[model samples]
Target chain A: MINVKQEIINSIKEITVGHDIQEFIEEVLLSDLGIDSIKYVELLVSIEEKCDVEFDESDLGADALKSLGDLINLVNKTLEQKVS
Target chain B: MKQYEVKNVPRYFEPHVNDCFANAYATVLSYMGNNPNFILTDYLNFMYDEQTEHIGINFFFRATPTVEFSEEELNSSLELAYLPATSMFNKTSPIDEVTDKDKVQINMYIHEDQDIAFTRLKERIDENKPVIVAVDLFYMHFHRAYQREHGLHAIIVTGYDEEKRTLKIIDKYKLSSSDFDGEISMDEMSQSRLSECPLNNPMVGEYKREIRNLWMEIDIDPDFKMNVERIYSIILESCKRMKGQREVLGHECGLNRMEAFRKDLLLKKESFMDRKLDERETYLFKTYYNSAFKSISRSRMRFKVFLEESNLAEKEDLGEVLEQLENALKRWDICANLSLKLGIKKSIKLVDDIVRQLSSIIDIEGEIINKLTDISLTRDLVTVSKNIKDQEM
Candidate 1:
């Protein structure tokens, strides 16, 4: 099985470009990821690809996701379920 | 046919693969060849600089709505749509309630010549077993460059010759007009070349067989603001009408207007007159229509700027620029909408609360680009660092 943390880390690295993820996650909202909404959707799609799952349109609701941790948590939960 | 030349017409590029124009182009191209499967992409490393070039061509045809389709979940992550045509080569997958096996596909095809292609289509469609070929309109924008200035636009691809430097178009400019045909030289393409073309005439024949979508722009300037103004006025007027009705209804029942209005909404009585609001869905209707108008305005401006500044001779970076601008606009748009929604629904103050949210959109756009650049730079740095370490070893 693919390492879930490693997969998440790689995906985050791909988007973060070279910026310290630790800093971004701690300091920035998920919306500040420096990409457009389309890219954000792409990131979600990428996450789905990396984790092997799908995200629904409902996940895009305003209050649905508040921070990077929330998003990562959501991805982790989905990944865990997929693994199970 | 009158040979019209376009001087300094505007051009546009989709910032990403989901661009409306690219999707529309791809659909049309797919319809032509009877291939319903196409993947639109704007992730090309090359960028087409659109600010300085003008493409000129004349077209004669009309546009009809086409249905979009997607591949099934796994192996088919791509969404495809059929372009309007009279006949198709391949039978479309059965849609619910569409049981006609003899149904002519409404996709069109582009060919070496417009007159020949269109005549062939008309004749084939007349045979009742319509061929599933669609017309290509990628060249129509060039042919109809003049008409765009007048806000008269049509989409159809008739024909082209890279050697002869000519293109023919079929467009639907007037309601009464049928297939209008015309052509233009490739001089405009030469002028509007971006800074990143790896090959000469990279855009040439890109839409011949199939064109993928990369991004969509909704022009949101004067026209958009006006649309918002109009909708707000109408909705506000409706609110006033409701307020007045509430006052009357409440007076009759000895209740406050708000209370009466709320009660009337709750109580289904025959006394409720047919209000224009019967067709209204406040959030759904308002948001969608407003979004469309905004898109139109912003798209038009972007197109204008792109055409005005493009150069055809440079190894233009057509793809990257388009994607960048698209990223900028879309992110800003989302932030703007979110801010408005928060203000309206959450009663957030417009100044401190909303501006901060709205401004973040631009920041996000800037940062994303910066981040990408940063990532690229860091990758280079790492490569150099690895190279130096290897040399030392």
Candidate 2:
């Protein structure tokens, strides 16, 4: 199984520039990290690349991707689904 | 349910003025089997408010000196201008508070649930009704440039497929050839309906979709004479009110709006001449000038068509006024072309020449509008006499 937390952190880092990585925590809201709709798309694209899985519409529901920790959980779930 | 598409719906693009409501209304009327020319003429009547001001530019200045453009205010202005019930135009407004008592009905509905919206859309389409949906531009995959830009726009949903999960739409501002008749995934369409963006208000990061569904039912008036009289009265009132001060937006009508735009352009040109123009400044100047020119020119063309197609043209001396308006429009076109060239070449001489020509055209247009206004008032009196005669008989 892929390290979903590390992959998500790495993907977020790739999409966002000029931000302090140390400030990021699992509980931090994605909006607080400057993840707008466009940037959110970018983050998803980066994570999909690392996880080798594409996200369906249902997978990107607003409630499913509320926080950084939530996104990490989603990445792990999608990865598991892809393996199955 | 069987699928149906409204055949030969007349499509119009008023990109510079943002007349999506008019376009959508026209589509609805055409679908109801109304004469396209008559419908178009009615559309032109809606362009001018009761005070003869261009509805799009009738912005209310909320506070001193600072002009604020609110879409909500504009919608109210449009309603007042069209006088939907009398003008034979479809009544439309935001879904939350649509209380139009007009026989010709158009209403909007918002649904938070995508499935319900989709089912409702398909049901309407099956019944040969085209639904106008307001969506955030960012999530509409077909609009690539606007895919990242968050702005609320309305498009006609012509068809949908449950099996393919695709939606067929008609976008008036077809940026590319492929955009005119386009399709987007249902998922994307739903996301766009729910998507919130910062374009309208930066402070409010999410914009709730206010107009999700548009409902239209047309009841065309059979009395041509009555319709003509109503139109003439509206035009006459607009002309008379042109002189009155509007509390919102400094200008009352097209002539005043053009005057304001000309003065603003001249001031901007002078500042650019004083300093080297940067790329951003040049782009902004081009956009402002182009939009202003196109809006006036297109509206003038529609006004000409309205005059020609409607019974109002038969009024004595009205033809001459129409000719004068045409001449002014032609001169304005030349000035706009020169202005465009000057923007690119940055020639001070050209700037001065354009400003002079624009001022002259504005004067000519103002004179023509006043003449038309007077003529329409006289026509109104004649109509009143004719109506009285009919009643006495």
Q: Over 4 Å off in model 2, which ranges?
A: A1-84, B1-21, B35-56, B59-105, B136-152, B172-179, B197-226, B244-270, B278-281, B313-316, B332-343, B346-350, B384-393
The ten-residue window of minimal lDDT in model 1 chain B covers B53-62
What's the true lDDT of residue B225 in model 2? 25
For every candidate, what share of the true interface contacts is present? 0.00, 0.00
TM-score of each: 0.23, 0.60
Question: What CAPRI grade goes to candidate 1?
Answer: incorrect
Query: Candidate 1 residues B1-393, lDDT tens each?
Result: 322222221122233223333433433434433221112211111111122111100010111122222212111111122223222222243321212222211232333343444344334333322222222232334333232221212233334454576644333232112234466444432222111111112112112112111111111112111122222232222223222321221122111222332233233222223432222222222233223323422432343233224332221433443455555455434433432342223322212322343244334334433433443445457769999999999
Sequence-dependent TM-score of model 1: 0.23
Per-residue alpha-carbon lDDT of model 2 for B115-177, expressed as tens digits?
666776776677667777767777766665455576556678888777677777787753221
Candidates' C-alpha lDDT:
0.33, 0.54
Q: Per-prediction RMSD in angstroms?
A: 24.8, 18.0
